[model samples]
Target: MASHRVMKIYTVSGCFPLIILLMSTMVIQSTQERTDSIFHYTYCAIHQNIQTDEEMGIADLLSSIAGDIQLRQLDLRSLFPAERFPIQIRFNLKNFDISSDAEYSIAIHEFGVIYEGSCALSGERIVVNDGNGSQRTSASLRPDDTGALFMNFIDIGISLTGQESIVGRSLVIHGNGQSDLEVKYNSTRLACCIIGESDGRSW
Candidate 1:
């Protein structure tokens, strides 16, 4: 009986270290898996109404689209020459799966400028050419109520400039509520509609 008891005590002591090591390894592996889920991207949308320069919980919204894309850093600069308050945006491509044929649209209520020009895709090639080709910026529809809807694609390289503002407004994209954004101004929040998103196949 004395020998058996001594053996049992030694066996439990030897297993304790192995069990702790296994648990530690599992914790590290779980943390790494969670880190991989985050993605990042950089984009600039026109804002209306200067209601408040407050930063909302937009980080979560940003993270949702950025999966595995890390937010390294951003270089924002004002568009020169016209200097009409053009904002150059930079972001990582995260959770949002981007395709070469995909296309997105920006809606402007008033006169604006798209410095880069047209957005086009030929075969597996994506091109952003000058404002001279058939792919020039254009105003597609004119709502009887809203007057007209102007849109254009952004060139990744070209510098875009114009008076784009949606400080207090909302825009619809891919039928997602993300297009709906409101800002408070003049003691009242207003809605400005702008920007649209479409699949790459159409591009």
Candidate 2:
């Protein structure tokens, strides 16, 4: 019995360093995965028919203007696991007309623009509408001269956990200028694209 105990102790001591090395490898892999979990999306083109809305008289003009405008990149980072603060989003536009005074807002929708069903589900808009005045002003839709709109590290006041995650959702860009509200409402949809990974998996 003494000999067996000595053998067991020897085996455990021999394997302890290997076990610790394995655990260290697992921790490193987990840290790498957590660091790389930030989601990325790219909006390429305007898929929907922008000229069909008769209520918006400038549909043709907007469509013509947006024909050259391309959403270059979108990067989204989750600040916390299930918290309602500090969700960072960045977007870059390309070939956009900087001379226009029209401002744009990005929104997350439940259904895609091509989804045919009840108008209720189709039109349900859940945007990052934190009513904090300064926060809202900071998050205001203002693109730079290079056509880059950065929602840099802003607290969007929403939980993006499990079912609340905005992945695989439809993202729409609304054209809102400092003009008539009706005009803004009518010409809201400037571009529409589904948010997906950076691996060209967008719909």
What lDDT does the true structure give each of the candidates?
0.26, 0.47
The 10-residue segment with the lowest total lDDT in model 2: 1-10
lDDT of 1 by residue, 1-203 (tens): 11211222344777888876776687776765554332112233332222223476221121112111011111233323343222222222222213222223222223222222201100111133334564433122211222222333333322322223222222211111232232121121111222232121121
Give the number of the best model, judged by TM-score.
Answer: 2
Candidate 2: Cα lDDT at 145: 85
Query: How many pairs of residues collide in each model?
Result: 26, 0
lDDT (Cα, tens digit) per residue for candidate 2, span 1-203: 11111222245678888876876687777765554444333333334424434575443333222321122222343455434434445454443446668666666667655432111233557655564743221124566687655334444543343555555556566666443432644545555566544543331
Which of the numbered candidates is closest to the native, going by highest lDDT?
Answer: 2
lDDT of 1: 0.26
The local lDDT score (0 to 100) that residue 35 gets in candidate 2 is: 48
